[model samples]
Target: MSVLRMQGIEKQFSGVPALKSVSFEVKAGEVHALLGANGAGKSTLMKILTGAYQADGGTISIDGRQVSIQSPQDAKALGIQCVYQEVDTALIPYLSVAENILLDRLVQSKGAGLIRWQQLYAESEELLRGFGFSIPVRMTVEECSLSEKQLILIARATVQKAKFVIFDEPTAPLSTKECERLFQIIDQLKKAGVGIIYISHRLPEIFEICDRITIMRDGQHVITTETARTNMDEVIGHMLGKSFAEEFPKAHVPIGETLLEVTGAKGGKVRHADLSVREGEIVGVVGLVGAGKTELARLLFGADEAEAGEIRLKGAQLRICSPKDAVDAGIVLVPEERRKEGIFVEESVKNNLSVATIAKWSPLGFIRSGLEAGQAKELVQRLGVKTADISQLVGFLSGGNQQKVAIGKWLDTDASVFMFDEPTKGVDIGAKSDIYRLIGKLVEQRKGVLYFSCEFQEVIGIADRILVMFEGQIVKELDREQATQELIMYYASGGE
Candidate 1:
């Protein structure tokens, strides 16, 4: 029997339909996959199922009985739990891992009495150990990395004895080894007869683990089929509504003289790193999590102070002590964590776009609103940022649009060297293409670019050269023609 079912589910936001007449089901012990592009309504449907958003029209059934769920508590009461894509918002930063994991159970067990800290710690430790997680129970959630937080959420769901669990892009932040561990946990959950709804853009993972697949496009369901019956090509065509010619649209640009060079740079996790980027070139940096890719970017961008290094731009040495110093030296970084580090969430799109160049629009300590608005409007059109108005809060935009704003903020400056850390991490395929084209444009303008990502395919597709880092060092450097997935992976995994 099917453990969960939804019929004619519909949802809308600000008069725009997010999900239309969507029907879905999951049987006991089944790993069901949900596939879609950004803005394809997959998240909206799951939000409704979790009671985070009420559907405009729909009927939900659990165990063949109709039910009404109006809030997250109601959904939990019916044995439904969700691990959303944005992990930071899902967890409380100030609380310890154990407290966050057993919060619900602790309240229930208390029954108006004092709490039992000893039992809670013991239970939380045992639960984590069972899942192969070694995180300390008393460690604050704020101190944990993104992957650790993801595992914590999964452990919490498992402990809740959820009959139905929804995992939304759970592997986006995980390394290969970490992903293998997650798959193992999922295997255990499946053996326990939990109906799972898995959502992801990574096609290979769906084939490897999912039993069935459901494709959605433009707020509508397109197809639902057994995984063994359909191939990647068929699935991609269904999700996109057409055949995709190439996964990566690489552009050719002539390489020029060196624009930026680093020698013996050491900061944070990065140790004795050396690299160079020439004008009209895109140099890709590929590494696993904790391999020091982000640390190198931060050192170059002056987000972290370098203890020992020589940084040169066009044969001129630079002393960059902070982000302001880096910007003044004609360098900028588009950070990986867009929501937390890159954007002013509560501000307007225009304000965000003009943030880096606000001083340029101010004359004699007076702000020139007209000039700022004009620049923001031009960037919005050039970057194809879809928004109702420039005054709209940036927090309300979709992931793709938000990323565009993050990159656009840097365009208003005169910086000639650009560094992007996981620029397309959570974006969809179409948006990723857009970002690639933008990078190509930067190269065509004779700007030097450093692109860092964990995905080898992205490094191979967009870069003129690829540098593999392992254990905080550049272990191998390969030209565009010589780099491949296997070769990059070998060096990225510390191969000699």
Candidate 2:
């Protein structure tokens, strides 16, 4: 029987249609995978159903009763719970794990005279144990890793005994082991008759757990089909709105002399490292979270200094004591957490775009407003960033649009060797293709880009040389032709 169904769902923002006549159904004891590129309107539709956003048109039915949901409480009361894309969507960082888990519904005395901490902690522990989670219930929320927080969120919805659960890219930041644990938990939930709306970019998890799959494009439903009948390429084609043809366009560019080389580096959490990124070559670094990938990038970028090592740019050994030193040496890193470290949310897009190249644009602390605005506008148009005005607050833009601004910031800097960490994270499919095209353009300019992502397909599809890292070590190296998803995952999981 269908636990929940959405028919003719329609929504828009500022006259821009987000979802147009989308329909889907989730059945009890079944995992329904929602597939779409970033900004494809999957999250928007779910937000409407959860009362976070109001639908301009549609009918949502729960077990045959048509209902109107106007807020999260309404959705929760109707037995619909959502674990959003950002795992800590509603979590308080400073609060204890138990407190966060039972935030508003804390067990209290005298109808809210005071929260019963002991009972809450004990119940939280019981809930975690019920879901086979091993973490201490009394620990602070900030103490848990990204995956642990996700597991806790899943546990929260499952413990609520909700009729349907919607998970949005819950495994994007999880380690391989943590992902396996989450899959097991999902299986347990399914056995208990809880319908799952599993949303993820990772295809393997879709194949592993989903009973049926629904593909969405441009906020409209394309098709919903049986998991057993559909192939991966067909699903991908539907998500991208095109068939997969030469996913990675790796051209045989004439690689020049080594541009930057890191020799025997030891600093921060990263150990001895020997790597080189050359002109006109995309060298990809692949590793599980906390396998020293980010740390290595930090050391290379001089965001953190190496305790013992040497960095060479153009055959000259240089000491990178700060980010400016690295930038002066023609090295730049487009960070993984673009929101935290990248664009200024409060500033205008044009200001954020020109901040990186203020010296080059002015040279003497003088304002060249016209030059900056023109450059920002040009970059925005080229990257296909969706925005009404350049002066609009970046905080208000979609994740993918914000990412374009972040990348555009660096493009204005004119750095040759670029290190991008999860360059496509949270970017929509249309924007992702734009980024793919942008990366291709970078290669054509004979510039080097070091791309790192947990997504195997991205690395396999982009890099000229792929280096697989495991436990803070490079385990395997494959050329573009030799690299495949299975081979990369094998090396990533320490397999054959």
Candidate 3:
């Protein structure tokens, strides 16, 4: 059987150590989970393996023979592939699905002859069909949904016939059905002797699909064990370097009069939906992908204009035409696509934390840098945002830290209703704890929070109440004590 192994892997970024003497190996036809919290060197190790970054020191081997992988081409030639979570950045939006799937083939065969478009589309269609998916090969990637984009990446990897494939948070954007499809593809790959390296923050998925698991912590290998030998609590403890008890950190904050109320709100994919968030309450909106949860948040936050609805804040009617109007009306949303829409990644953490409320620090139409810095420092500490200082670019931080900055930016605003759509989508367990605690603190301050997410378990843990959306409408509401995963799925699937 083929084997891929890396021993004594070491890497540093700007003189800061990222990976320290890490070792990992995977055998052909086995699903091996490479797991760690964000910034825990798992990504660093994978980058070195995929040739995105070279290790400062390490030895890599395949089937007991040392191999050199200095670039992505070298890795690809050696039958290695990676399916990253950031699908849009990796895909060509204007290209047809077939072209994107066969991109490497086109690049390799450049100037060979006239491209046979029909044959290419036919091959792509067959490939997708082989995987039991029905994505239109002729459709432009831009027209495909987020989940479809993820599948395209997976398909591209399979077409490459990779010996070792790494799936990084593959289910982050996928629906239940799409996730099952992905699992089938993984199963097929395994049966064909492909080594699968799966990485995700969801413990349930890991326990379900992976055969063996490797845990990393603080740039070092913690343990490698058979999946059947460890439990979720044990795995989480190893990942966090300590025993973790409060996974959700939900606290009791007395619910008060309604702080924000929406009636018949309609926008993009959102139909006439009604909801309310009381002071010191967290009301969760849960749904599968394309179920209009995000659309509802967008309309409430004025990211999209409402065609018809009444949004009242503290019993005062507000006309919100745009995001600015929503912010001015004391409503703010931390969007689902945090990198693209929630925060400016190119800017520093301090700047990101202050941008939304810069006007408050700038009485003379010029921002007081000192005051802004001070405020940022406080928020960073409050939000537990890990950075080399507030001036570090937010793009350099881990997913969880970046998310903290995204939510922190709006803390200074006069927004009473804070809307977070999938705030913990890619965040890890430790960071998720911090975020949940932050939400608790927000509610303690009597700030009504609208937590929109597909992670029903998380919502059930942290939210006092839950609203399930189906298609473009809210179909059911359940208190935390009564909500269950099965019930949420039933409502999300349009049950009466």
Candidate 4:
């Protein structure tokens, strides 16, 4: 039986249709996946259902009863809770774990008409223990790791007793081991008659967790089918309106002379590193949380200081004390957090695109808005960045589209050596394949690129060679042809 049904939902933003006649139904205890590229109307549809946006046309029926959800509280009262892609920010940082969990329903004392902190703490600890999670109950939100924070978020939601839970990109910040734990928790929830709406760009995860899958493209519902009835290729086929074979292209371009060489460099979580990457080749850096992969990029780009070491580029010793020095030398680092580090939020897509190479385009000692606008517009179309206007504020864009803006910044600058740290993180599956092709394009231009990813599968797909980092050191390096998940896991977990 259908527990929730949404029919002919229609929404528009500034006279532009965001969702057109979209419809779907979720059965009790089913994990229904909502799929789409960035700006593909998935967010809009959810906003309508959760009362963030009032639909212009459509009917939402819960258990065959017509209802009007005018606010988030209405949705919650109807047993609806949303866990968006950026769920971390939804938490209160100053609150303790127990306080955050039982926020409003803290057990109260009767006689004194006062709040009961002790009762809240004891009940919260028991609630967490029900799930076998042993996290510190008194710890503040700021003290928890990303994985801990995610688990706590889920726990808090499940405790709400919501019959329908919407999880958006819950695995983005979790480790593989932690992800396994979450799947286990979801299984328990399913047994308890809870329905889940899992939204993620990870195709494999949809297969692993979802009972039914719904594909959306360009703000329209493509199709909804059973997990066993469709293959990955067919799903990708529907997403792009055609086939995208070889999603991860292995560049066979000849490896040029060594373009980057580092010896004994130590910064952040990185220590005593000696490594080199050749021009026109892709080297992947793989590691778990706090493994120093990102810190290595920071040191190389001069965002973080080196405790001791020398870096030589093209056989010439270079002193890169800051990001400007590195960029002037034709090296670029695309940081992991696109929303925070990649671009300015309030700026136009055009301005953000030109930020890296603004000095070159402004060599006449004045800004060239015309040249900047043209270049930004061209790059957006070339990179398939979906935006109605190139002059739109980047903060209004989706996660995947925003990432393309970050990549466009470097492409505009024509950076030769690119460091891509989680370039495809938080992006939909469709955009990931596109970014992979862009990486191939960079290598075709003889640009040396170093890629870092938590997903070992992605490393195998793109890297010519894989360097595994653990505890601030490169413990293992394997040519792509020789690497395997078992091997990568062995190195990552200190098995080898």
Candidate 5:
């Protein structure tokens, strides 16, 4: 059997240790789960394995022979492939699905032959069929939904037929059916003798498919054990270096008068919707994939145009033509696609945290650098954003920390309504608690909050009331006391 091993892997960023002498391995035909809390070095190790980042010290071996992987091309040449969670960075939006799937092959044959469009599309379609999913081969990736884009990335990885594959948070954007399909695909890969490294925060999935699990904490390897021998609690304990309490930090904030009201809102996939949020109340918008929850959030935030609707804040009708208008009217949205729409990844954390309220520090056409830095530092500490310093690039932070920055940007604003769409999609349990705590603080301040997510249990634990959407409309509304996972799913799937 083939084996991929990294012994004593070490990596650092700007002199700060990220991974310290970490060791990991996977054998042919086994799914290995890599578990860690955010900033726990899981991503750093994977990046070294896939050659996205060069390890400062370590040795990698494939089937007992040491190999050097300094770049993505080097990794690919050595039969290694990865399906990263950030699909946009890996995919060319203007290219068709077929083209993106066959890009590597096209590059290898650049000067050898003419383009074979028909054969290419056929191969892509065949690969998609093997996954038991069908997406139009000719459709541009930009037109695809996040779920579809994830599928395309999986399909492309399959086309490579690599000896080892890495799937990073692959199910974060998928529906239940799609997630099951991915698990089946993993089974097939295992039967074909491919070593798979699976990284995810969903413990149930790790137990279901992974044969062995490796836990890391504070940039060091904690433990590696057979999945059957260990429990989820043990794994989480190792990841966090402490026992975990899986509870939403929902505070007891009394619901007050309605702060924001929407009537007959229509735009994007949101055909018709009416909703209301009261001060200090969290209104959860729950839906299955493509059920228009995100569309509704976008429309309310003015990210997309509202074809027809009445939006009122404090009983005053407001005309919101853009995001600026929404912000001006004391409304803000933390979008689902955080890397793309929320924070500026290339900027420093201080700038990202202060951008939403930049006007507060800028006067007479000049920015008060000292004041901005002080406020940024305070917010970082308040939100628990893990970074070396405020000057560090936001992109270097872990997924959970990046999310905190995204939400923190609006915290200093005078915004009365806070909307978060899939806020915990890629965050670990610990990070989720921190985010929930932040939301609770917002509620304590008597602000209206909207929580839009497909995670029913999360909504049940956090929201005061829940609204279920189906077929681009709000089909049902239930108080928190009346909400259940089954009932939410039933309405989300268009139940009568």
Candidate 6:
């Protein structure tokens, strides 16, 4: 028997349909996969299911009984919960882990009274222990790593005794070991008869963990079948409405003389790392989670001070004291955490696009509104950012569009070298293609790029040369023809 079902689900926002005649169902003890590209209404459908949004038209049934869910509280009462991809927003950073885990329970049990601090901590500790997690109950959520926070969200859902749980892109920030642990937890939940709705762009994961698959495209249901019955190509075709020819489009660009050279760069987790990128070259840096990729990128971007290093740009020694110094030296970094470091979420798309080049649009100590808007508009159209208007808030856009805005803002600068740290993280396949095309365009324009990624295939697909880092140092460098997934993994894991 199905534990949950929805039929003819229809939703529209601002006179445009976000979902259309969608139907879905989940059975007890089943891990059902939901697949879709960005802006294809997957999130909308999940929102409706979790009662974050009321469906404009649909019939929702729980245990064969039709019900109306008007709020998140109602969804909780009906035994539903969701773990969103944006973990930072989903969690209360300042709250203790114990409080966060039992927040709803504490509020309900207190209701105008002081929380039972001892009892709450004890219970939360036991709960986390049962899940094989050893996180300190009193530690602030802000102090935890992304993977730990993700596990806490799962524990919260489990504590709620949810019959149906929706996990949206939960593995995007996780390491391989953490992901394996998550898979184990999901197995436990499945064995406990809980229904799981898993959403991810990683096809291999879907096949490994999901029993059934439902593909959605352009806000409509396309296909639903058992995971064993469908292949990756078929699933990609369904989600995109056509067969995808190449996952990565690596363009051929001639490499020129050295553009930026780093010798014995030491800062943060990066120690004694020497690297160089030539003009028109895409240099991929591959490493494990703590292999110093991000730290190295930070040093290059001037986010962290290099204690001892010589940075040469265009054959001249350069000293970068701050991010502005890096930018002024023709080096710009598209950060890994787009929402936190790369964008001003509260600002309009226009403001975000023109932020880096505000001086270019302003002259004589005066701001020119017309020139700013025109420039932002052109870049918006050029980058294919989907927004109703340039004045729209950047936070409201999808992950892919938000990323485009982040990269677009830097394009206005005359930076000769660009460093992209996990540029395609949390984005869908279609958006990834767009980003790859953009990277190709950058290299074709004779600009150098430093591409850092945890995904080996991405490095192999986009990079002209690959550098594998291990334990805060570069262990090996390979040309594109010499780099393979096996070889990269060997060096990334500190193999001899």
TM-score against truth, every candidate: 0.95, 0.88, 0.97, 0.91, 0.99, 0.95
Ranking by TM-score: 5, 3, 6, 1, 4, 2
- Give model 6's clash tally: 0
Model 1: per-residue Cα lDDT at residue 18? 76
Candidate 4 vs candidate 6: the TM-score winner is: 6
TM-score of 3: 0.97
Better TM-score candidate (3, 6): 3
Record all residue pairs in model 1 with backbone atoms less than 3 Å apart, i.e. clashing.
none
> Judged by TM-score, which candidate is best?
5
lDDT of 4 at 195: 85
Better model by TM-score, 1 or 3? 3
The model with the greater TM-score, 5 or 6, is: 5
Error of 6 at 65 (Å): 1.9
lDDT tens string, model 3, 1-496?
9999999999977677888999999999999999988679887798899998899998999999999999989999999999988787789999999999999999988999889999999999999999888999999999998889999999999999999999999999998888998999999999999999999998999999999999998889999999999999999999998988988898797899999988999888998799999999999999999999888988877778789989899999999888889888889899888888988889999889999988878997988999999999999999988677788898778888889999999887778989999999888899999999888888999999999999988999999999999989999999999999999989998899
lDDT of each: 0.90, 0.81, 0.91, 0.85, 0.93, 0.91
The superposed Cα distance between candidate 2 and the true structure at residue 401, in angstroms, equals 3.5
Stretches off by above 4 angstroms in model 1 are 109-111, 360-374
**Poorest lDDT segment (10 consecutive residues) of candidate 4:** 103-112
The C-alpha local distance difference test score for the whole of candidate 4 amounts to 0.85
Preferred candidate (lDDT higher): 3 or 4: 3
The local lDDT score (0 to 100) that residue 117 gets in candidate 6 is 88
Q: What is the lDDT of candidate 3?
A: 0.91
Candidate that beats the other on TM-score, 3 or 4, i.e. the better one: 3
lDDT of 6: 0.91
Clashing pairs in 6: none
Q: Which wins on lDDT, candidate 1 or candidate 3? A: 3
RMSD of each: 1.9, 3.1, 1.5, 2.9, 0.9, 1.8
